[model samples]
Structures are given as C-alpha cells and as structure tokens.
Target: MDIGILLLGVAVLIGAVVVSATGGDRKIARLDRRLARVEQKLDAIAANLGVDLPEPELATVKALLAEGKKIQAVRAYREATGADLKEAADAVERLGG
Candidate 1:
C-alpha cells in the first residue's frame, strides 16, 4: 500500500512539474513575441531614417524616446553625427520621430 502511495505521489509531482514548465514556457514565448515586436519597430525607425544607427545608439535613442527626451534625442543625434540641429531633426522626423 505504501509503495502504491509513493508511486502516486511521484506521478503527481511529475505532473505538477510538467504543468509548471509549460506555464513558464508560455510566459517566455509571450515575452519573446513582445521583444520581437519592439525590435521590429526599432528597425522600422532606423530604416525610415537615412542614418545607419549603431546598435548602441539605437538602444540609447529608444531609451531616450521612452523617457520623452525629444530634445536629448536630437542633441544626441547631432553629437553622434556631427550634424547641425536642422539635419538631426530632419533625420529624426524622417524616422517618425
């Protein structure tokens, strides 16, 4: 009888582990999809702008934009490219900035 109970407990533990793993996988998948979408948008923004932004610059600009740092974005663009303010703004506007 104890042997049967032990087997049943092991089965239940295995089932619970499987269920938990499946749930974790689902959450990871959703996070991956969300990340993919954000990456696509970033790519689109980069493409729309004529400038070829490096990965670091792109990431920084994304963070700046998220923080509502429009002026900072323009300034950073100018500083990075040594472009004038007008040119920087133009590039940003082209990118839907």
Candidate 2:
C-alpha cells in the first residue's frame, strides 16, 4: 500500500511538471506571434516616415518586437527622438528596413 502511494505521488508530480511546462511554452509562443505582428506594424510606419536608424539599434528593436516588448521598444525610440508612441512606432517601421 505504501509503495503504491509513493508511485502515485511521483506520477502526480510528473503530471504537474508537464502541465506547467506546456503552459509556459504556450505563453511564449503567443508572445512571439504578438511580437511579429507588432514588428510588421512598426516596419510599415518606418517606411512611411522615411527614417533610418543604426543597424545595432534596429536589431535590438527587432528583437524587442519578437519578444513582444513593443512598449519598451517605443520608449527607447522615444527617448532617442523625443517622439510619442505614434511617431516612435513610425520611426521604428522605417528602421525595420
């Protein structure tokens, strides 16, 4: 009886781990998609604005977009240009090129 209980406990623990891991993976995937969408928007904005940024900062912004951190990316761009969200996103869109 004791051995059966121990086995059951282990099985439960394994199940819990799997569930948590799957949940985390799903969240990460959702975030990735969101970032991609946001990046596309920024790229469009940048192209319309006809602006360019250094490759390094542009790369960082791209990574931030992929990570679903648009607000952060916008803030960074705003700091550099003293621009608001719309302007900053537009600048980013141009930079995406």
Q: Best candidate per TM-score, number? A: 2
Worst 10-residue lDDT window, candidate 2? 53-62
Report RMSD (Å) for each prediction in the order shown.
Answer: 13.5, 11.4
lDDT of 1 by residue, 1-88 (tens): 9999999999999999999999999999999999999999988998899658664355555567678887888887777677898988
lDDT of 2: 0.80
- For all predicted structures, in order, the TM-scores are 0.51, 0.56
Native-referenced Cα lDDT, model 1: 0.80
Off by over 4 Å in 2: 57-97
Question: How far is 52's C-alpha from truth in model 1 (Å)?
Answer: 0.9
Model 1 segments beyond 4 Å from truth? 54-97
Q: What TM-score does structure 1 among the candidates reach?
A: 0.51
